[model samples]
Target: MVVLPATLVPRLDFIPSKPHQRDGYEPEFRRGILFEIDLRTFLATLITVGSYVRIMISNLGRIGWAVVFAVLIALTIPWFLWGDGRVAYGLPVWLWWHIGWMIVVSLVFTLFANRAWGTGIEEGA
Candidate 1:
């Protein structure tokens, strides 16, 4: 039997580089849209532009869109809202939050589809 040298062995301590990162094993990240500051501001602008754009394409304006976006951002984050060690419907409070959030998202999506959906594409294009 032949013994392999250690140089041929793969290192177990290797750290993987994450996507959108600039360098390997470094905290530096690539310049991307998400890396830009003012995430909340950006989200607000996006929602506003999207709503107006939809209005231009369709007669109906986006309704309860800001509320939906606010709720989605608020509920998706697990920091501010704690579980409180409470359980409901055989599920934790935090889990219930997500479930309710999903239901709200589904309803909002349906509403957008029926009333506010727009691709910003021209009729001929």
Candidate 2:
């Protein structure tokens, strides 16, 4: 979702006017590092919880995205554990294998999201 992407990826800002001699461009993200982390945590948790609640309420008869959620969890668990602190923290060769696995699983879930909830995974404009 857009909110998750915004929270996860670093934000970039543009200059007020055109190119300036003194500076090229400066990012004006939230002031501190903790601010970024805390906001991301809050946003991610809120979205995840809210989505879960919505699905349970509206689709009691229909089974939900069991496989997608399961795959996300299954892959994410070992991914963080795969690394040796500094070196493989960013999903090395084998972890990337898991990521590739997730990609395949996510496509199936995308169709499921579209069909079940009438919400396309493409999201916003």
Candidate 3:
């Protein structure tokens, strides 16, 4: 009692290739299901996403550095109040402090990835 969409149902003109020869090999016309996909495209998409996850998880040092930066920023309080309640460069000093922290985090992560992660490739190869 299997049901399939109209588009997925095998058409009358569609013929399955035979690998071996038979006495009277008239192509069997059966109402069977056929599924097709480009192997290269499927594998490429799978590999790309898998590689991204692998690289992100493999870089333990980079993750640790980012976590430390985040925790430090969250716990620090003096910088938030050190701005003398004034604005600088059209933004509050506290806001600038946060912006600077973000920049530092980006730089540290980039450096760690470049020097320690090593492009997510194996060491020997």
Candidate 4:
């Protein structure tokens, strides 16, 4: 079989230096305000929230149902107080408050799932 010459291959360094030089068009990223900060902060918050969830689940076996129920009720009832608050980050304060509450509820549900549902499958089964 005949082999092709190496000189025929295109070199990356020889390519146009700029986008406009290569294709006569410059592309824009168009990232909105707070894009970078928002992503970093969101990831950090998610990690912190996950740690809290793990702690909550670990403690579930010790806390009584009454305490859990009380906390659940207290969290739910606070929504009324959040109404008519000043806006933050383009969303009503109450909306952000509820979003935080939802995260707690989700962690509580995770605890319940682990304790009440037995983590789904057995090691041997």
**Number of the top-ranking candidate, with lDDT as the measure:** 3
Which digits, one per residue and each the tens of the lDDT, describe model 2 over residues 1-125?
12223445455443122222346565554232212235567778889999998766655524346555665667665654465444356655676566777787778777765666553333320
Clashing pairs in 4: none
Tens digit per residue, CA lDDT, model 1, 1-125: 12223343333334332334355445553322222335466567789999887666453232355556676777675665574788888988888778887887888789767754552343311
The whole-model lDDT of each prediction reads 0.56, 0.53, 0.59, 0.57
lDDT tens digits, residue span 1-125, model 4: 12212243234343332222236656652222212224456567779999898767655644564477578778775656554868899988777878898888889888776765533244211
lDDT of 3 by residue, 1-125 (tens): 23333365445345443332368665553334343335566467789989887766667555775677678667445454674778898988877777877787688678766766543355521
Provide the TM-score for each candidate, comma-separated.
Answer: 0.40, 0.29, 0.32, 0.38
Q: Rank the candidates by TM-score, best first.
A: 1, 4, 3, 2
Rank by lDDT, highest first. 3, 4, 1, 2
- Residue pairs clashing, model 2: none
| Top TM-score model | 1
Q: Model 3: residues >4 Å from true position, as ranges?
A: 1-84, 118-125
- Candidate 3 positional error at 23, Å: 99
Global CA lDDT computed for model 1: 0.56
Residue 95, candidate 3: how far off, in angstroms?
A: 0.5
**Once model 1 is optimally superposed onto the true structure by TM-score, how far is the C-alpha of residue 25 displaced, in angstroms?**
95
| Model 4 clash number | 0
